[model samples]
Target: MTTTPDITLRSRLTTDCELHLPGDPGYDTARLAWNLAVAQRPAAVALPRTPEEVADVVRAAADAGLRVAPQTTGHGAAALGEQDLDDVVLVKLAALTGATVDPTARTARVLGGTQWQEVVEAAAPYGLTALHGSAPDVGVAGYLLGGGLSFYGRSHGVAVNSVRAAEVVTADGALVRASATENADLFWAVRGGGGNLGVVVALEIDLLPYAEVYAGMLLWDRERAPEVLPAWVEWSRTAPESATTSLRVMSFPPLPELPPFLSGRDLIIIDGAILETDADADAVLAPLRALGPEMDTFARVPAAALTQVHMDPPVPSPAVADHSVLGPLDDEAVATLLAQVGPGTRSGLMFAELRHLGGAFARPAAGGGVLASIAGDYALLCLAMAPTPEAVVAGKAAAFSVVRAMAPWAQASLVPTFAETRVDASRFYGDEEWERLLRIRAEVDPHRVFVANHAL
Candidate 1:
């Protein structure tokens, strides 16, 4: 791979934005990704705080014959790491962050690098909230572009469907607006096409009207997986569209930093949002509650608090994961999953999760993007902490093992958000959708100047 000369890169981008060359003092820090497990060494890294700066950097990079890879928190860096970044300009958007809420319109206009927590907090006072992901620190651009699945998903729809418009800087450095009425095709492609076509600098997304929600978790010892797992799966099958939840068989290493209930323990967790009245939510949760969990935190809380319900690490950490969209889980399928991370099994995984999908999740939204709906019952995700190289190897093997074991019940499709590494991009969309995405990608980025986590 041929890299652009440092002098050429500096000459083009130095006046436009903050540029970090290979040997620059801040290059090492600027190139770090959220997933510490991924080591991405792009030819250079640029920090653009405004749309104009972003456009300048994009044009400069393309003029220098370098491909531009736009990244926010780098949560999905593993997928981008799979490519050759020797000739790529890593555009870190961490400096471009902010959010504005229009309560009257029930929408939020957020900068590309804004985190879910920012948007949640900004809208909380308005008694409104966006369909944010479980992790508060997750970048909005990457998540929505990849068809974000949320606790409100079953009741509403995938987060992308809530998007009204996006301001993107195309490969040619032209900033354009994409929505149902403006740059229509580009808008459709971007909703699920990820950052393959351009650098998304701003997005105006519709917010949920929920001021408060009934959501939380129920935990039981890992020993109860044999019983609790099946019960939750059964309940999920018949659960109303107003409820969305996930079941996880988790193993925690002995660490003093963790809470008593999670540290050095093997447990089963069931958690999510139940969009119903207090009485109605209780009735819907009766069956699972009957199983008698050691801890039940499900109750009515402010919608903003839902971002913390899943207890995702508030800070960046090293992790590796494998995922597959699964159809209805039968007895054999549940049994196979149990074999991998059952009570007595040493799966070496942090957690093996089955996010209950279906409900409105499987139905297409009107005027939605290419990835309007996920055609599966559950999204199976297995993740392992990978703080060390040896651990990364083991974690990958352990994670892939469970995914491979459950392949018989897995669907041919995948949810772009859950995918940890590069896979068949076509699996995320239908044949016609995939073809249309390709055509639009070629038109918007004829030279393939932009490289997204999941390339279209």
Candidate 2:
């Protein structure tokens, strides 16, 4: 007689999700990401197709005495530590990709597995777009779970704020919906809670009636940072909620892939943003543009040109990535940083970005949102390549110093994607929310089935 399989989480996941164990040929490559410093291999990689399948995989992992590591295109591929990674199921939901748009309501249905680029491309046809993180390849699930900020943050709000509903699979291998009406508290936690509760299957988010945006950058010389950095800050204070901006002080690799102006040089970049309107982008950019640029790539482009914001390399590279939120940018500190890591320093640091904050971002989500509580984030992104331990240490020190100098303005939140060491779960969650997450975990995943490689 044929035997029935166990319907618990593990039984459902055993086969439905693609499993790539250590001996698999592409396992090493699959376990890495755009950022090279972070990479790791779990006992197996589970590519789940649906919520039921994901639930099944988790149950199967539990049955097999394995922990689950959730992964999206955006996660650090190599940061897992040896102490906790002996036997784990790396959950990859890349197969659950696709998005549908509703132009009339300015909304779209996003599969938790879909990447930001997919949504950008899908919404273009309807003259509507989802304000997503800088990189198109960043997954929607991680972005939303991490309290997603976007290009349209000034005009709209975090990607989590735009979410109307979610379809999720609880730890028990049960599929359910979380909206205003059902599982309301769980929905609130997911908004800014950083996925501590459960895995989301699909997200229905509100879309903006955005067509073409005055989206592009204003490149300046490193010398201009003294003049431009603070100017951007001053400009931010008076900036209408309509415009969004960011300043980046970075060193370009001496690779042929870079343009002549930006190649082998330390440069400062200003990403100027605004909605699709008759507003003259140049007018807003004039203050920064006035400082002068050794090279400039600024221009009005289609919103789908998402890569331009971070200018993150399309091809993965061997590099180290880390970041911190700046509370403020003092002139002396800015000067010290420019002198140390900018143009002539030849510091081997790839990019240092300063994402402009305030505007709508400063406003807390009214009822609550599911995400790590990120109160204020004046983030500084530092990317570097460390061929030696000494170089890595130096780069880390330099990056930290910058953040330390700017710490006066740091909000209590951190982007988990950038965590290199230590994840204080309490810092990621507010009092009630943090307690609520633990309670949910106890009720749903009593075995502590999920543990993030980078802390909450």
Ten contiguous residues with the weakest lDDT in model 1: 1-10
RMSD vs true structure, all candidates: 1.1, 4.4
Q: What TM-score against the true fold does each predicted structure earn?
A: 0.98, 0.88
Candidate 2 local Cα displacement, residue 356, angstroms: 0.8
lDDT of each: 0.93, 0.67
lDDT of each residue in 1-456, candidate 2, tens digit only: 112222233344555566666768867766665555544656777788876678887667666667777777634543454225557667777878889998888888888788888898999888777868777787888778777668788767666788888887765657789888898877776676544556777889888776667777777777666677777776766667777777777776687978787787667777756764545666666666677765556666676775456676665555555566656656665666666565456655667677766677667666656452344536666767755667667766766665565565565666554444455656655677677776766765676666664433
User: Which stretches in model 1 have alpha-carbon errors above 4 Å?
Assistant: 1-7, 14-16
* Tens digits of per-residue lDDT for model 1, 1-456: 265544487788645699998889999999999999999999899999999999999999888889999999999899998788888889988999999999999999999999999999999999999899899999999999999999999988888999999999999999999999999999999999998989999999999998999999999999999999999999998899999998999999889999999999999999999999999999999999999999999999999999989999878899999999999899999999999999899999999999988878788999999999888999999999999999999999999999999999999999999999899999999999999999999998999999988876
How far off is residue 108 in model 1, in Å?
A: 0.8
